[model samples]
Target: DTAVSQTPKYLVTQMGNDKSIKCEQNLGHDTMYWYKQDSKKFLKIMFSYNNKELIINETVPNRFSPKSPDKAHLNLHINSLELGDSAVYFCASSRRGSGNTIYFGEGSWLTVV
Candidate 1:
């Protein structure tokens, strides 16, 4: 079983459309996160959750939201998608205080046209 899994590995949509990427972790982690890697491959943290509580939130637009229904799932929803939103979104999970042993999913590639 995959430790972390995300759906729709690739996505292409028109600008102004709304989209979502679903993620799940079976590793029983206490923390989950959403990270974005731009075309330049510079990775950045968009949001983070610890046991369903919002922890770290970076300077991202309000159009993006991270929803966690439970500790095992974290979903990323984007509204009014823009061309600049195109990138690989990664879902990761880790046990808090584990010292850098986070597991990541395959990543959802979103391309807004």
Candidate 2:
């Protein structure tokens, strides 16, 4: 079974539209995260959730929201998508700590036109 998976590997939409990406993990990990990789390839943590609890990273915008239905799934929802939102969003999972190895999904590319 796949350890982590994200739907719609590619998304192309116009600015101001709302979109959401679904993520699921089978690794039985307690912690899951949503990360954004910009055009420069700099990865930044947007949100982290453990056992359905929200752990927001300060740098993320208010327009981005992460929802965790359970320990194994974390989904990302974006509202009023802007041109700046064009980037690759990666869903990751870890055991829940600084020392744990983070496993990433294939990533979903969101392009705002």
Model 2: CA > 4 A from native: none
lDDT per residue, candidate 1, 1-113, as tens digits?
A: 98899999999999999999999999989899999999999989999999999999999999999999999999999999999999999999998875769889999999899
Candidate 2 global TM-score:
0.96
Give the range of the ten consecutive residues with the poorest summed lDDT in model 2.
Answer: 54-63
The CA lDDT at 98 in model 1 is: 52
What's the distance in Å from true for residue 35, model 2? 0.9
Per-residue lDDT of candidate 2, residues 1-113 (tens digit): 78999998999999999999999999989999998899999998888998999876657778998888889999999999999999999999999889999999999999999
> lDDT, candidate 2, residue 97?
82
Error of 1 at 29 (Å): 0.3
